[model samples]
Target: MLTIPSLHAALAMAVAVAMFTAFASNRFRVEIISLMTIGAIALLLYLFPLPGTNPKDGLALAFGGFGHTALITICALMVMGRGLVVTGALEPAARALGSIWRINNSLGLLVTLLLAMFASMVVNDTPVLVLLIPIMVSLAHGGAMPASKTLIPLNAAILIGGMATTIGTSTNLLVVSIAADLGMAELPIFHFTPIVLMAAVICLPYIWLVMPRLLPDNSPEAGHEPRKFIATMRVGTESSWLEQRIDEFREKLPEGFSFLREPQTLQPGQRLAAFATADDLREAGRKLGAVTAPRWLIKRLSQDSAKAGEDLVEAEMAISADSRLVGRTLQTAGIEGVAVLGVAQAPSRGFAAPREMSAEARLAEGDILLTMGRESSLQEFAQDQALLMLDGARPLPRRRKALIAVAIMGAAVLLASLGIMPIAITSLAGAVAMFVTGCVHFDKVGRALSAKVIVLVAASIAIGRLIGDSGAATWMGASLALGMQYLIPPVVLALIMLFVTLLTNFASNATAAAVGTPIAFALAEQLGLQVEPLVLAVLFGCNLCYATPIAYQTNMLIMAEGDYKFNDYMKTGIPLVVLMIVSLSVILSITYGL
Candidate 1:
């Protein structure tokens, strides 16, 4: 017999379905839809309050996400990530990974996937992704694969790894603890590891090869060739390349970098003519212990920046037709505060350099100058010289604070991974430390957070709470249980996994685990089937939070970086969901002898 749901339960289900539809359609701005969702939930609950709850309580429930610990943890994680970036703490890691990528794109992605997957087995998923996201983005900026092509695959690998162990995610621990409390045998940490590992064998190929193809290239400068610049690199006295033959140093240079003319043997303070993109030039300089501008200029700029309490920034300035710099060489351009590191001529003229051009490169109207200094100085220099400043002014890393930022991040991850304190507290403390230690500035904190993510998280929290509180989840579980008695054991297990997957994708992993675990136990009791497989089904399903951004924090974390739409998740994730459900269903059936 079918029973009609009460008004609150019915309304909650309707709201959830409608919200999912709106997100899928991609018709409205995510923020608008999210805010409207929150508004609808608050108004509906206020008009038709849940049993034993007043209107004020309803408002609190709807609005509580702004203060929710999960949101706080995410915000703090962003701030800490900003700290790492501003301090250049992750550059070495990025360079190492970029080397692998430079060798072979496929091999680099495979290594990245494996690293993320296995690391999350012991560490939590969020921090693992946090540590890797910036590295991947940096690689993308360095002319490797686009971040859009890599981040989703990386996120999937981490989620799968997180599914492998009981300690992989909080939701996994919740499932285990709930099952243990329900009188089931306590699952050891690695109890389900082999199963997820086996499933991963079936899934990794899809993640590495096909997923990247499905993702669009979201690089801001997609389809445009990076502008290459001719720069003179001066070897520092302490450089390892000092006293090496020019040919030997040439052989050691990175790809895309080349000398304009063969020079004499390398010597301290010797300048070599070279041409490469701005990023490649920076990389070459870092690797070879060389400076594009004079060491004294850099030192002076550093001192000026310190005195002004500002960070050094690199910016591009175009020589306008009417500019005073036209026909003047870089040495005589006489720009103050900013040092011109390189000159990029109009591409149609080709890269043919005259003899001694790097040292005496004449400024042309269409030339773009790569300069470094304080942001204020760059702006003022551009204005005074009638030069057009490019939009992006990238801050040079403050290497002095790099170690401090690294230590703070390590401590936060350590405490959270060791279960000493909740991630919320540790991450918050780390964010505060970043501010106090000058790793990230107080005024720059807003740059770290995304309004899209904020509103979406708030709305998702409200939806999750409403679904759990209004009996919608319970009603669905009961309906599943009623239908399961007629099905065979494998079908029942698959259905349970699918059910929890839907709940987790739409509501939350916590809510799904809370509602699904007892349902699994009851189903097992009624059907006289083994309880562990069913419980594992619920556990596995909770981690299959791939089909929506609201399904997991890491999902939203990658959204802005990847420039993903709601449809992007649905397109790539829905197939993976089916694959896992089928593979896990069979694996569980065989493993437990169902």
Candidate 2:
């Protein structure tokens, strides 16, 4: 018969509900809510210590999440993703994918979704998403889709892929391992792939077409009108532009970019002036084998600036009306500690390009100047020269280390995929290599991490621990068993999946898997039914973590980037969870003849 939960169990449930409400209300920052939950849990357990647990044990339970394997793994993966980005290791692949999206956004989205699913089946979902998230953001910035609309759907697709195989997700392995210990047959790698694939087929339409529509556009406006900077490309002997028709690259040219003079044939040492954003100019310069400015000047600045304990930064500055550098050419402007790459003469009646606007482009009032130098030096230069500094800051990509970063990433993935070592070790080793090899600067590691995500993850882990340690999870399972005893097999199976889905969405999937596996086995024994279908229900539910950010690590990883609110998860994910529960329940009933 159904019975009342113990006092500790009731308190644990109450705390979990309050935490959920706080997360959903969005009144406070995620970090604030998470830290508050941790403090409350610690204090409650200390005062009302559960059975054998002491205050010391209570403190450990509260603080243990900071050192969790899952947290470490997530942080390490983020650092490696940073290394790939700063080194420009994924630029080629991103550009290729972007070209396809430019051709047809719908087709590109479909291909990207399929690719994520397939890739995660072989490798872990976290690493796969880490690699894809930046690429997707780049595509979104390029106008394929808003990041808010794409990241959550993309993350969901990866989760579906991870559900397909035994090696797909850590929780999948945990479920399989726990089932084996409970006297169930150990499933093979592909044993459950077909079943999950079937479920995915039913859910794919919603993820691709419906989810993005439901999500609000959260992409930053800055991406659309990124600061336009003037830059001159000094064509070198190795430049592909040498003796080539300028019209051949017309389609590839960045928006608002044009030659100062329509040259029939490009020549070595020719200076090509263009108005483009920093990212566009850097990409064009790389393609043309050209330097944005003098190589010797950039190298000298790098050395001198480092000696002064400051790294060089690329910035856009505007020439004010009161500036002394009104009509002086770039060569004669004589701005020290900064290199003038290009100048976009301020538009008057029509457009006024000084007589010789190539290498000798002159600065006019209201003209934007693209310069590179130490942050402090840039500030000083702006102040002394009476220029207004722009808001955005973009670092130059480390192209020299691009190949090295790619090799390190490949090696790490290979070592882990081959079972040579655990993914945590491989990922951590890759992160260290990124720092040691200068692919990612040590100081920039902070940029890769989100303080909000770290604390939320720690809090989620602590909540999961409380649920397990206070016997709340066991109480929940027994209550579910008693309440659902009268239902038919198919309805009972659906209820079990639904229950586990709720657990996975609120608690960690790991907790759900740990708690639900044994319950499924015992309940099957009591009902005189096959254990396979019930075990499958638990496994499917563990991966149906769509309703909350804290439900899965990837969900949290995308939260800050997508600018998602708690309601976004509930709105987009709950439908998918329900669909899966219904579809999987019917599938299991037929497959096992329960």
Candidate 3:
């Protein structure tokens, strides 16, 4: 019999479809669509409240996600992650990993994938990715492989590991809790570990070897030529490298700089010339204990800037033909407000420099000078010196606080993983500790939170609640039960897995967990089948969120970093989804004797 849905169920279905359509079209911004969805839910539910619930309750359901613990946890975790980056807490770890990658790219990738997968089984997948992303990016820059090629595969492996434990991801716990509420026994932490482990074993080879080849290279260096500049470094008397040999500093030298020949010994006030990008020159100069302009010039400018409460800035500046600085060396140039870090020699425009450009090389027309100063003074210095600025100033890392930041983050993760406190509280406390200990500046907190992700999570939570509260998911399950009446038990289990996988990949995994568990329970009862197999199918499918970014929080986290498109997930994820569905169906059916 064809049955009609109730008004609330119909409304929920319509809104969910519309919301998903907006996401799939990729025409509207995710944040905007999420805001619109929240507005629609608030407005619609106010007008036509659920039969047994008050209007205020409907409003609560619509607006509650903003205050939801999961969303707060994500935000807090992001802040903790930001603290790690700003403090350079992960640099040492990144360098160690980069060494392995440098040894052999394939071996390094295999180790990274396995480590990420195994860690996620014990810890939450998000934190594992958070800690590893910078390391992977470092490995990519060190010529191992592009992050775009590795991150998606790494994320999929982490998801597989999360599926193995009952508490690996919040979604897993949600599924277990909902199943228990529906009269099923509470599952142990590793209740389904064997099955998920089998799936992992089957999929590990694809994740490690095949997935990266399917991805495009999207690192910052890809598809663009690097802007090169010539810069000179003047060794200062008080610097650590004042009398050090050039060869001693070779390993510590930043990218994009090379010497004419390795000097036997450094001399005080020695002029070292090199060609590199502005950013590279700054990094190299900082590490080399070398000043961009004359030591006296930088000292005087730094004193004045500190007195005026302004930060010192570094950037590349180009010399114009009519400039008064055209023929002057760093010692002779009467420039103020900026100090030179490095300079690009004339007639060379790329990374491959034929000869070393020396510090004593007089400024020439079109020579790019890596200058450092306060922003206002840098602009003034540019106009007064007849130089064009190349790029914005890079933020200096708070390297001194790296240990403190690492400690805070470690404490939070330890507390959460041990079940001493919920992730929300621990992560939030960690974020606050970052601010309190000056690990991260309050002004930079905005960098940590992605508005697109926040609003989307909120909207997805609302959609999940609506689908469940309105009985739409159950109605759909009943329909599936009627259609599968004649199918054998194993085939029926596969169909259930397929359905939940669709929900999980198209909607939030939390939403799928919330909606699918009850439906699986009801459908199993309706068909007089073993409910455990059907419920396990839902659990496995909910974690199979490979087909879309919106399906999982970790997916969204990797989007901008990996530079992935909607179609990228579809291309790579669909096969994984199919594999998991088929594999898990057989595992569940046989294990439960369905």
Candidate 4:
């Protein structure tokens, strides 16, 4: 009843439960708890080595997570995502989504969820999330729904899509391969897709409508309304709006954007006065393929930025009362090293016509200027001109490298999805290429990684290894097999699914698949039931990795971006898990005639 090996396995399970409780309590920081978890596992394994394993071997197993391929791949994907953002490679996608969101938030979210699900069905889920995460963040900045409200749902949709096909995720492939090795017939890519599709119909409503409400609005800028500014849009010969009628261009502008004065027909060298926030103004320019500053000034800034090998940033500077540049028009202010993109006058002055402002608008005290240039230049100019520089200086997109970043990301995803190379290798190569091509600066790579995510991933890997190595996973499987003998076929199927779901939620998916597949096959033989449904149960259960961040890599990927607490996963994920389990059990029961 109580063997020495079983006791060791029991201890491992106890440690896992305690660690999870610590995380859920929220009494300690995640990093602190994660470090403690790693330390505890290492000390426990070394002090009481499992049978046939030396203490030194146990130590190696405990600390091996730091160098694991999953960790490496996650870090590389972060770097690549940073590259896409800094280079504005995904602006087009974000703009398109932002437009839809501007009309109806619910409609936009529904479209995004559907698109993410389908995209992940063909490509790997991780890459699909990688490409979409930045777009979601961009949409958040552009006044769409907060990223917190959307990222988890997006990740969930992607994971569900990955479950639909054999090649959707590595874990799926592993499950299939192991079942085939155990003498079951190999299933095709779309063999069980119909089942997952049915389940998705039941799951999508919750993800689209209720999930966002359950999540907290974690936007850092919440409660702070953005300030609007008056800007001039300069139409050059190359602008798409150059020859369009003013009314036609106005129809294309974003809602709530107002024009100071309407021109009959847009022409080269014509200046259009527009009033909107800095972000909105920039977006307007992007939509019209126009620029805000003079062509020469923009060229000089670009050339100087390239020569300095530095990315450009947009900063706000308010002119002080004693500033020497007061009373001078923007055209005559002669500010060097920065381009003035927009101006916000103090005391809520009404907008002026472009012709009047372009020719005679003077810089006055308390007027805030939105200037774009190198960060160092902005600071220096602010100090030299007696202007007060505001916080929140945003990086301007490096458009020159946008295509390069997109191509590199596309190639990596293609290689990984096609099974030509491992995701770890392809992602690592893409990260390196981003640095080499200046899509992401070497110094700014630190901003891409989160310490919380790193420690959490490391600890999860260690815990997974401990559960597998200590025979805890095996003990649990055998225990479940013993109890399932008396149950009816449908009940037995649900129990197996539930047991594997628990293991996959707490341990890694690979561990669950490896331990649960053979157990399910053997259980089927003993109980006189079809093996395919049981095996498929294990596969689906492994994907039910919704309850914990450590359950899957995509879960961890969304952790920091969503600013989610451990309890957030439990709060939102537990219900989805139960719903899917019940729905899937019934479907499997009916499909296989259990």
Which candidate comes out best when scored by lDDT?
1
On residues 376-475, what C-alpha lDDT tens digit does candidate 4 reach at each position? Answer: 8999889889999988588888988999988997898778766688666888999999999999888888987767667766776676667666777566
Off by over 4 Å in 2: 115-198, 209-230, 252-256, 301-312, 349-359, 485-497, 500-575, 582-594
Name the candidate, 2 or 3, with the larger TM-score value: 2
How much is the lDDT of residue 317 in candidate 2?
85
Query: Model 1, 449: alpha-carbon shift in Å?
Result: 1.6
> TM-score of each candidate?
0.80, 0.79, 0.76, 0.77
Against the true structure, candidate 1 has what lDDT?
A: 0.82
* TM-score sort, best first: 1, 2, 4, 3
Model 1 RMSD in Å is 5.3
Judging by lDDT, tell me the better candidate of 1 and 2. 1
For residues 1-594, could you state the per-residue lDDT of candidate 2 as single tens digits? 667888988898788878776765657777888899899989999999989878889889888878876567667766776777676675676666667788888788877888889767755677678778877886776778888888888999999998886667767766776677558887765677777788889989999999999999986655545556556777888876678787877677554456555667678888776666666777677677777889889889878855664446788889998898987887787777788776655665346434444547566788888788878888888999999988754576677789998888778777866668766688789889988888877877898776876786677677767876777766776677677678888898898888788877875576567567777876776677788889889988999999899788899889998999999999999999999888889888877777
Q: Which one is best on TM-score?
A: 1
Provide the overall lDDT of each model, using Cα atoms, as 2-decimal numbers.
0.82, 0.78, 0.76, 0.78
Candidate 2, run of 10 with poorest lDDT: 349-358
